[model samples]
Target: MKKIIVLLLFFITTVTKSQNELGSWNIINVNMKIDSKINVFTEAQLRSLSFYNQFHYYEFKAGVSYKINPNFSVTSGIGSYNTYSEGGDFELPMKNKEIRSWFQINMKNPLQFITFEHRYRAEQRFTSNGYRNRFRYRIGATMPLNGKKIVPKSFYLSVWDELFFTDKEPYFERNRLFVGGGYEFNKKIAFQMGYIYQFDYKINDESGRDFLNIALLYNFDLTKKEEKEFTPATTD
Candidate 1:
């Protein structure tokens, strides 16, 4: 399709522009459906200023999600986040060591082959510097390239923009924009890679950076053995 080709070209162009300064952002996510309305999930991230080198940041988190309806869900999570100096691989004298807890809400609207998603989150951060409160919102859309829905062997495209703010003066904090695509290998596994541009206001540790984002997602259903319709995992 003409639209698909245009999108692909845009993706390639953007990545090419930032290739020289691109950082690495990698994630692993696992989700398990424990009941009809409850799910448990865990995620980990590792990041570097270069392609697998100059490692600087990492985080691990686990949470529970409750589906309130077909269109809405709520989640709560806690995580350990660490950031190191940028010169070496996780160098000494970490810049920031943080324990973060967050509450989030998600809403979805599906139209034909595309789904529009909205996410809102509030975070309580306990960091080496001090305690802080932050809020974020993201709007995203996903479209299946090969089928009406994301199923086994399907390919999909996703794009999102997120804004972050804090409670103090100069409240506007950061912005993140992501564009990427993924392939569904089966009902349980999928892999995604994309480009992300992040901009921070007056933040010194993790400021403006272009990242190559890669993620692996796994989903499991514990209640039944029968195969069901696949639901693609969403990332932040």
Candidate 2:
């Protein structure tokens, strides 16, 4: 894909920069609550069909990230989902497995009261309905309200907005917006939650689709450190 190639080139360029950009690796767990309504036109025109047997999904993902430094990181992930319906779905298909990858850059001092990060994600979805790919990018900022005041820098909070696109090759389009929060526990673990909203697909008397998600994250440094340890003296 064109987007994939662009990201790979950008990563190579960043690595060639003089400054060292690396810290550690992180592991995260993600859970998603998703609902979708699909319509299949009996006729090929696709305008003569009624929506039926909406699909619902509960997805769980395992993600791993490689930090290039304090400013950037790339993550890879995979997800498995559970389908909630089996009726009126003979013609339509649903989600099966997905591939997730993303690149993120942080633009702020680690000690600053606030920090911002840009994240780009691409997904390969193989569902019963069809195989589709999607791209999403997020603008996020972290506020260290308590991290600045607490010893050992143990706590922080963050908020983010995700903008997504689907079917960009044949016809470009926007998908949804995600608003979310992150809460840190100690230095190695964190919690996150969010709501997702789909736009411009409105129908009278129906609320738009939304998701309530929760995630657990574990992050730490992995850079090689110089050896410097003071040994205790032995008395003869």
Candidate 3:
């Protein structure tokens, strides 16, 4: 059929132009609760172009979150990124930086055997080149491997797919697919390691990259108790 021919040609062209590269992404995230409805978080990341070396970039972010219910939450965050050349070159004309602000909404759904999270995000970016805006959506699912729930001391499987879009001519930006597993150390900390496949589209070419993803997550609660005023005793 005509459609089959077009599909075959597309696959052939993609395979011929594909340049596979390996990279690593490391993340640390901490969340602190201010009250039942409010929370804050900080995150940092180190990215590399090689297995464990050849530094690529670093990012820092801070954010506040508000919980609407058990299943829904909203967050606003600001981030700074410093990026170098592919081989860790930081010389002039090879380095760039960006500042970005984002807002996101997250929702959770419980299924029979798997739990799913839906995230919608919008970003305002100020890059070395200019300003841009993007929107993203991701759907993630987790299933317990050794227990009924993803509780402490349990391992779970995690998978997600995300897509990015812009408002320009080529509205489609990028896509990411991830598969990984996490082990909950306790109620407050956890670790996840996985692999990510990223596909990016440009004006005339497309590229594919593979990444090793590593993450550490920390959670704590410090909700304020009832407010009270203290009266000092007056001497007579």
Candidate 4:
């Protein structure tokens, strides 16, 4: 009986020491089309810990994308991020800010029931500490649950996996997996809510900061209206 009691105590202690917190990430994104082949996108995010009590970070990003064709596009972006330290018994909030510039390429394939997308991005980061570079790749798929496409009044499922790599110490940075459901209000507006699981190599010991991710997206088209084709004057 005593041996079993000791083992139980050890197990409980290990679990308590490794406990992690859950967080929330909320974002708003907008995309505007400049023409048939070009677009601009903007995003803002609020990230929090402890169910929105403890503020964690804020991020703003803007980018331009050029569609090479229906299936492929390239993007370049710049972002500013401010991160705060988690508050605790003796800890105080301090801000660490970073600026990042990135470029990405994306490819898409459409199937009967699902669409698959692949993205590759490279980033150059500037921070108070120093400069760093990182690379990331993500594979994602979306399927409509109620309609043929993610059209108005349609519900959809989205799933993705992303890997992060860096040139700094611990070359492997992190990995993320997300599963979500979204509703398309129209071609211009949509909302998604999901859960994201992230594995961080820098933070050892399964820091289970799995997050609730929420996003509101808006899309706009700015393409110039096509002019009517020139008509030849009819000769009487």
1-236: candidate 2 lDDT, tens digit per residue? 53344345334432333433221111233222121111111100000011223333334455444545545655556555444333333223432323333333323334446666666777776654466676667666655444343223333444556665667453334444434444455444455444334443322112234333334544332333321211110000
lDDT scores in order? 0.85, 0.39, 0.71, 0.70
Quote model 3's TM-score. 0.82
Tens-digit per-residue lDDT, 1-236, candidate 3:
53344345334422343456567778888887788788888889887766677766788999898989977999899988777766553323446678999999989897767888889999998888678888999998887666667777767777789998988868998998877667777767888767777888872211346777778888776764532211010000
lDDT of 4 by residue, 24-119 (tens): 778888887788888888899887765566766778999888989988999999988777666732124444568999999989898988889889
Best model per TM-score: 1
lDDT accuracy of residue 133 in candidate 4: 86
Instruction: Return model 3's CA RMSD, one decimal.
Output: 12.6
Q: Which candidate leads the pack in lDDT?
A: 1
- Candidate 1 lDDT over 4-94, as tens digits, reads 7636844683568623577889999999889878999999999998778999999999999999997899999999999998789998789
lDDT of 1 at 20: 58
TM-score of 2: 0.49
TM-score of 4: 0.82
Candidate 2, clashing residue pairs? 21-68, 21-69, 22-68, 22-69, 24-222, 93-128, 93-129, 94-128, 94-129
Model 3 Cα shift for residue 212 (angstroms): 0.7
How well does each candidate superpose onto the true structure, as a TM-score?
0.93, 0.49, 0.82, 0.82
